[model samples]
Target chain A: MSKESIILLLFIMVLFIIGGCQTQELNESGVVAGLGIDLEEEELQVSMQMARPALPGQSSGSEPAFEVVSAKGRSLSEGLRKITLLFPRNPLVAQANLLVIGEELAKTDLALIADSILRNPSIRKNAVVVVAREVSPKDVLNTQVAMESLSATAIPRMLRNQERQMGIYQEVSLEEFLNKLARPGVDPTAPAVTLIDSINGKAIRLEGTAVFKGREMAGYLDSRESRGLRFLNPGRIQGGLINIPAPFEGPGRVGIEIIRSQTKVEAANTDGQIVMRITYIGEGNYYEQTGEADILRLENIPVLESICAEQIKSDMQACIKQAQKLKSDIFGWGNIVYSQHPAVWAELGPDWEEIFPGVKTEIKVEFELRRTYVTDQSLHYQ
Target chain B: MLGSCYDLHEINDAAIAQNFSLDLLENGQVAFLAQTTQPVPRSETGETQPSQNISVMGTGRTAAEAARGMFLHFSRLFLWIHANTLFIGENLARQDLTLISDFLMRNRNLRFQTCVYLVCGVSIQDIHKAMNERGFAITSARGITQQIETQAEELGYYTPLANIELLERMLTPGIEPALPQLTVIKEGDKDRIVLQGMGVIKNNRLIGKLNPEQSQGYYYLQSKKKQGGLISIAWSDSPNAMAVMHCTQFTSNTRPFIQEGKLNMKIDIKCELQYLETIGDDNIYVPANQQRLEYLAEEKIKQQVRSCIIQAQQLNSDILGWGLTTARYQPGWWEDMAAQWDQVFPVVGSQVEVECILCSDGLSRESFRFN
Candidate 1:
């Protein structure tokens, strides 16, 4: 080879080496999928859930799908350093999907826990935030569920299901949750997670809700209350089921599947007495019938509707009552008042909590029964 | 020139962050919380689980300082590009959003589309902890924030408040910024992060909020990217039966007028919707019934707009940007009253004209074909 050609080849090789050495190799560092925080015995506990990519020596034919390690220290940075001491791999969270907090930690001052998670430049802000209930976040991080091989993957999917379904639960990210926490004249809420013993075995189910009053655990809403609150909120009702007494069917109950519904909230302030009017316009189809009387009689449809409306009202009332009793404006009634009557709201802004309970509310429900299953009459009569 | 490079580090020596949050410390300093990913190696046993992250914190007098302090004892380089969202805590948002906003805007790694959330009722620390939890309760699900921002009107009162857009609104004249409200609710076994509605921010502070219903109206008047909204109307005066419409393809045209030296706004809204469902005894097969439904929609929509305007005036935060719209139409009049927008906006009267065209009702109008 000529000397010039040899120099060119060496130059190209040098360029390749320089370019490739700093490039990140996937296997060198484990991919981070999730993170968790908990305050244990006045100590900071940080946990990491990582994916096990096959690497040398440890890969040995097969490898565990995930590796979780936690460390505790006096400070958050100390806790984080201890995690590296406990685990062999460096946690890379570029692709992580979620962050979790133990209920115990959530109940305490949150600003402390958030400082560590927000300061790091390596972490993204879009990961979903989940609060563990009746269990430490670490326990939740350790358990693996079906549908997704990793707990991190499965949990986000489960959250999506909740958002698309009956709205019995809610999903929030770090940014969105913090936004609510910062804003005044409004409170924040999130869905609750609990380990349940089901027919399929121990699994994670997001149920009810956790109501917050100024960063503290103020109250809660059951599944029914959640559904009722969803009805009150002006949003799309994607899929939900409501059951009512089928008196015409002789003491049986019937279920109606909500295809879509719309709610309107209007508030008026007259002479300082606030009157809030709520209207629920629902269009649903008859999905189930354990009743006897032929609801297809056309005349019975109105009765069924009235019954449905009554049941919905009761559900809404229960949720509203709880919110008022707890003095937590989960429904944003104070905001509504402020929006409708800004001048009046200016006066009531500081004392919203005092006036929230006494504000009279009127709830009206209207049901449009679109259809009654495939057959006009229940199969029992047929 | 085969020179040795000294700055190269292995990927294992770097911390990759997935979630980032901003808060204020007690000493009036900027505090950062980052949820970073940790790669765990598999043991000889072929069993490897996935999805693990670690949180690192830093505190400094300025946001940048605190972010830098996060690496006090850590030896790895911190990467900022992977974070997907930025949360401003209650104290951070209330004190001065610019504490984090100025840094995030200047950051070269972070994108403008990063979802920015206003923390209302909970602490960012709790949010970070929950973001790391598994088996998140349905009620407490950390929902897809991107989806919520895009389809904010789905719950009736938000527009996509991306970082760039939010900053522009804060800087723009005759307009204020708003963001999706995130809160944690505890009910029984469920502790959920609910995107309740919109938080109105004026002068870099949260002044008020738009409830879900008011949020729907706010979207109609203020937001430009109007997708569709869930509209409910009373079919009759009896309040017995109602019709629900899922409307899309919305367009709003606002006409500003200088009447008697006072600001008057006439908003003309045009939208098409498919009748999704009705809870009334009225039959849809008759064309007259369809027209009646449309008329009811028009009236209901007018009422909705009126209430929305009323709310905007009450806040004295022109979130609807009515002043800006008027400015676009009448530059001379806008200049005359622009400085006095705060006063003019409160007394400004609006008239709404709605044309709701019910294009299609789903197949098989009646429950049974025989009927």
Candidate 2:
């Protein structure tokens, strides 16, 4: 062959080689959007939310958006492979963004599941992890959402929205969770999910923060406690509201909108006694008032500030107390001592748990009111 | 061999799915819901109208069986590559999530970026009925994702999580997962889906939920980025007097130490804000008034942070990941106490320091006083 022909032949051969790999056509592969894992009767139950594409020139009016397939086996791999028996197309999980863990499986041992997920090369490491509360993962994957076409995608969006608007829960990704697990002093937590009865019907909601001891779950933090946990973390707070009794002698209340906040904790070895000094500073705007008090005057502002400070001091104290009661170092006090006073930690390390409950604390709070929105005067009624 | 078209598949032959949902029936069977978009033809002007959405339901003893059942009602093979959302019905979410996580991690066709949501206060059937009644298009998977991407940071309402992240939290030792919750509200004759707060998961079970306020606290604790939101302060002297500030910038720093053999943490937060609106006749531009405003803002933030901390302690859930900080800074002490860290967390004391700066005043420096 001529030189050009030879080159052309090589190019054609390269094309064939590239296309020769075991590649399934779009129609031959079932794309998975979500996956659920459950353990029942010592068997692994796996469910997959598979996408169903709408083809052109076909009657797609009655077709659904996706389908769910499930199988049971002794192992996760076996269960997933068994899906082929029921699903005609090869199951593909590379696109899945949501993973649900059954309550039983999460309680038993997540090490095996973690191993399987980490070992898998095709799985994405950024998928959102959730624990099914009082429900099975299969059922979660099967539910429909009114706002979004798929609940799998909508769920994560909802989490993001909650994080931004409420600042009550943190979303943990696979990679971030693994990093925390591998760390020494930190315990892992995951968002809990459940179904609830609403006026429209049964809906999905994120309920609480799951507390973990080692690999197993220790307990959970209710909404209030969860917010307290966020407060302990210096920068976790975004925006929230604080309601305080009107800083005057009246049966009224004032609502403050948080704009910025910071917390500082110092551990001092004062005269052989461990004392934790917590200073919290915050900034916000005047939001609402429920009583007919002209507390907006410049003279009364200082009193309002002090009252708000008192409220904060009490809240931090309560959070600390709750952590003490749970016996879970969700606050990392032990870690704090170890880092700040290595010598002291060395002596008290073994007995840190016993020493923690007796630790003394001093709290100082300062608040600043930044701006008044819209108007500068209260409504004067006849 | 020459590249052949032996495995060629036409787009017209496949069913493109946009959303997937799972529900548990009272009969112990799993129900699957799928929402697919139909291909729309172009008009004579070469413009295509919106595609039609179709819904299909299937039920079976297992997830795989239910999926197979979907084929009975439909003729085309289901394609999941484009599907990006999954919904868990109340019954299913309350039961367990193991099956879902296991299936997702092992499957090759699934993407780890798909979002997960828990259905609360409503059933999948109810949602379907609501959609049918309104004749609304259910292709909102992209819309929800877009909303989260565009608004989450500014709104401070929810945190978005994907499949791999959820599994990692369950499998990881130190941190836990917090998933976003969803619920439907009936407005007039229409039903609207809204994001609630978040669910706290322990050992893969949903134990409780964080309200919107608590959820905001959670977000604030972990957020490092500059946030945009409104902070409103109420005047104690006047019931109807209020002031609102728009947060322009925020930063938080934490310091952990051992003082007097006690574990203590020091936190410093700084915020920059703009004066937006007020309900009372106060010239905040006056130096004294500005100082007062700053104090009020600081006090409000301090109180909010403190309240959040108290609430967390009550729940005994360390969504704060404070343990990680301790472990990193004080490895020696953490080693001995890691096993019983839970016992040490509650008593840990903290100090918070906050500073607020008012950067600007909207349009007019003086309040609009009526004669």
Residue by residue across A196-239, what tens digits does model 1's lDDT show?
Answer: 65322466666567777767767678877876777877655665
Candidate 2 RMSD to the real structure: 26.6
Stretches of candidate 1 off by over 4 Å are A1-382, B1-11, B38-50, B73-76, B135-143, B149-155, B367-371
Q: Could you give me the TM-score of model 2 versus the true structure?
A: 0.48
lDDT of 2: 0.68
lDDT of 1 at B132: 53
- Candidate that would win on lDDT: 1
Q: What does the lDDT read for residue B245 in candidate 2?
A: 82
Candidate 2 docking quality: incorrect, acceptable, medium or high: incorrect
